[model samples]
Target: MKLLEPPVSDYSTVFWDATREERLLLPYSGDRPFWYPRAVAPAHLDGDGEVDWRPAAGTGEVYAVTVVHRPGPGRAAEDGPYAVALVELAEGVRMLTNVVGCPPEDVVVGMPVRVCWHELSDGRKLPMFTPA
Candidate 1:
């Protein structure tokens, strides 16, 4: 089965580019960092809509996790038993990513993880996490 590609767009070019270099860049408005890069910062921020990109520490802990046994459309069932997790980064941001490089059943909440990359067929790297 073909792997899914990331949702890259004008507002997210920086993020996609960083992954290619093995870097994790998060978008910031003043001191507040947010995910899913967009044209403007979080609505609560009073600063101008402009944003800045910052290098992430690339370390986090599994805030939550689940093992997927069934694949969605276009995906293969043999890819079952993969771990999907909400990783709470040291920077205070939570990211939805897959926990790999280890057995799916072994992933647990509060387990430490570090950034890893999966190269895509289109020459872009997708960021995932592995036990630190």
Candidate 2:
């Protein structure tokens, strides 16, 4: 299926690049932490723009989730009653993604999940969560 989204720019480019590369990217400014990409470190209020990008452990647990029986626009092939889960990575960042590899009814809160790559029609890979 073709999922469409706008191209990322600015500090968030690193995130899109990492997703295409099938890796998890985390942003760090010195000792401070950040997510979703920003021009400066939110903790120290530093505009140094000295962010560092690094790979993160893709292992995580399903913090919470819900099954979408009715697919939304452009998500028709996602299968009825598919799970959308809030995955809490080992780094403590929680990202919402689709949980695959099993029936949606079988998924439960706090279940173990791992990052997996789903290839798009354009050859870019996106991250998804699956049973660990």
Candidate 3:
């Protein structure tokens, strides 16, 4: 999914673009990989600018979650009380996102999930998770 507040760095721009294409990018440090955008490679990696943008499998297991009983400002009322989860992707990168397509009670730790994108009115897509 696309971020509501788009990142302002060149490296992150690649990430936003990939999300628009319905893909996820995982940052790699040689054979070890991670997520979230960073300017430098991991301390153990030996090369400069060695990080490559690779497509993620977009599948994960729910590591944690919470149900938002109260709606936040600017949030859609229809989406209130939604379950937001921390998903640990198959690549070992964890991302925080809302989990849709199931009741709040149905969301649980270790549940299998798939990445899904939602397009906002401004034409930006945001990543979300749903039960697999």
Candidate 4:
């Protein structure tokens, strides 16, 4: 799939940059995880909306999954059948990414997974999930 990066001008740049290094970075503030990689603090969005990038454990469970038998674009189209999943990270946040390194039929909800990377055409590494 295409690895889309937020522009440096965007607040989510930290998330994209970290992934480029093969790391999973999450937006966190206070003591909880502010998921979906938004640059917002857990509480007090108006005041201390400032966020910090923290490393995620990279271990998670598949919350949901869908196998694409035919993709219209991106590597999924070239590669054919692949699994897209919502992975619930150990940090208590869920991210939508692809599940690789196995046949798509093998992906299941509640399946254990770990972080992996797929180098995109743009030379950026995209985080993917795989059997742990």
RMSD of every prediction: 1.5, 2.7, 3.0, 2.9
On a 0 to 1 TM-score scale, where does candidate 1 land against the true structure? 0.92
Stretches off by above 4 angstroms in model 4 are 1-9, 42-47, 72-76
- The candidate, 1 or 4, that scores higher on lDDT is 1
For each candidate, the alpha-carbon lDDT, in order, equals: 0.87, 0.77, 0.77, 0.77
Model 2 lDDT at residue 6: 45
Best by TM-score: 1
Model 3 residue 25 lDDT score: 75
lDDT of 3 by residue, 73-93 (tens): 446666557787899999888
Residue range 23-117, candidate 2, lDDT tens digits: 87878777555665666666554647678887888889998999887775567664466788888888777787888999988889999988998
**Against the hidden reference, what TM-scores do the models get?**
0.92, 0.80, 0.80, 0.81
> What lDDT score is found at residue 80 in candidate 4?
72
Candidate 2 TM-score over all chains jointly: 0.80
Per-residue lDDT over 10-126 for candidate 4, one digit per residue giving the tens place of the 0 to 100 score: 786666667778988777775667676664565643446777777889999999999977673444366677788999999878898889998899999999999998776555677
Root-mean-square deviation of candidate 3? 3.0
Alpha carbon lDDT at 76, candidate 1? 73
Look at candidate 1 and give me any clashing residue pairs. Answer: none
For residue 14, give model 1's deviation from the true position in Å. 1.7
Candidate 3: residue 20 lDDT (0-100): 71
> Whole-model lDDT for model 2 versus the true structure?
0.77
